[model samples]
Target: MNLLKKDLADGISFSGEKDGHCITCLEGKQSRNYSEELEGKCLQLVHSDVCGPMSQESRSGGRYFLTFIDDHTRKVFVYIIRSKVEVFEKFREFKSQFENQTGKQIKILRTDKGSGYVNRDFKNFLRNQGIKHELTIPYSPEKN
Candidate 1:
């Protein structure tokens, strides 16, 4: 273990040999990757995604989950939904509450453009509100 090695180098001791082989540690290590910089103002950019139809439903009978992340603040809001159709209503609620509380308008929204998000009604709402929609390419969720 690196901890044991550091302790030994620092003059700590143990009576017996210590084995360092760890299956989980060897399998779990990951290298860091580049990420975009944060936004300059709260509500300037928001990212959203929906994950759903889980094999096992939650106690509340919800099969989908939605998330909204404020790019500036890195604050996350999560909600459980019964189905993907709830995404538009949830976004309306999120936008209303977030804008009212923070006294700032959401200028841009980034998402993966799933059926839940790319509907005509949803696009109309964004345009009506003067909010820009940025859809990520398929298979590139990190773009959000």
Candidate 2:
């Protein structure tokens, strides 16, 4: 274990044998990869996605759930809607609430290339507000 090595280097002694395999050490070894930096606080960067037309409908006759995730705080906002057409209205509500609460404008939005997000109205709204919209390439949820 790197911790054990560091402890031994710092003159700390352990009664255990050094020849034995350390689970912690083995688990700790990993290849590093670069990850994108998270935007700080709320309303800075939001990832939006629509999930499901469930096999069984909800009590309110809703089948899909739209989720908005704050990149920095990892807070999630979920909206249950009957159709994808409601995404714009739900997103508008989310935008207002997030900005009101955090006092920060949403700078960028990341989402898959879903029509719910990339439609003319949504694109125009983002452009008019000077917000940067980022969309994943077709068939690439991993990018989003």
Candidate 3:
């Protein structure tokens, strides 16, 4: 503003508004919130969650649904399941099939700290495949 005044800005001037905040300057310093996707490469990160025990079951007798989302691409894969036990299997299948199809390995997985994902079998599978698992705090659905 001082430079503009000294160098002759024709119609724009801050000469009288010298004591308060400058909206333009403040806005210029702000930035968009950073997303959880690291480096933004496809298959780099995934988010998984299960929503189930629904009141109305699907025609196939599915009582639950599992979801797998690619953080970078925002691609979503949903699986209707008969039970929560299917979560681990569905996740494994999703990982294998997606990796094979894309020719890229998933480096990380993010999920809520639910039993379906935190069980011994699920932990073993993730460890064996070298996939990092990030768990949202329990009860904090917003973070998930």
Candidate 4:
């Protein structure tokens, strides 16, 4: 620090470790705390997400899989599909089966703002069924 001051920076003052531990270091020693919210009732809230165009397809030539999760029961349902177009069909199938088994209609459907769930047909179906559709904040997959 003294060498640089003499050779280049004559006007600027450079302090080398003047204080003790930094603010960042103090914070880094602790873990983050997240607030907890109330969980919904069974079939009252459902989350759906789609993953794929996998490198290898399924035996039926499916390239994608759709997932549905129940918030209250922590139940998960999955369907293998050939493409994004099959999302609606698969969702309908899952909804029917789940409703039949649980005797409850899904009240809310939460999903990312992906094309498969954002299309017109998907929204229309949700509306017709009187189910609320929730899109997670754009660019925040953690919300999903």
Best by lDDT: 1
Top-scoring candidate (TM-score): 1
Instruction: Name the regions of candidate 1 deviating beyond 4 angstroms.
Output: 1-40
Off by over 4 Å in 2: 1-41, 138-140
Q: How far is candidate 3 from the true structure (C-alpha RMSD, Å)?
A: 8.8
lDDT (Cα, tens digit) per residue for candidate 3, span 1-144: 544446555576443433454455556668654343333588888888888689999999999889888877777999999988888989889988988877789999998998888999999888998999899987665665
Q: What C-alpha lDDT values do all the predictions have?
A: 0.83, 0.78, 0.80, 0.79
Number of clashes in every candidate structure?
0, 0, 0, 0
Instruction: Please give the TM-score that candidate 3 achieves against the real structure.
Output: 0.70
Mind giving the per-residue lDDT tens digits that candidate 1 earns over 15-126? Answer: 4443663344455575433222232488899999998689989999999999999987788999999999999999999999988877779999999969999999999999
How far in Å is the alpha carbon of 52 misplaced in model 2?
1.3
Estimated TM-score for each candidate: 0.71, 0.69, 0.70, 0.68
Model 3 misplaced stretches (Cα beyond 4 Å): 1-40
- List clashing residue pairs in candidate 4: none
**TM-score of model 2 vs. true structure:** 0.69
Per-prediction CA RMSD (Å): 9.2, 8.3, 8.8, 10.1
Superposition error at 83 for model 3 (Å):
1.1
Which lDDT value does model 2 have at 3? 59
Of candidates 3 and 1, the better by lDDT: 1
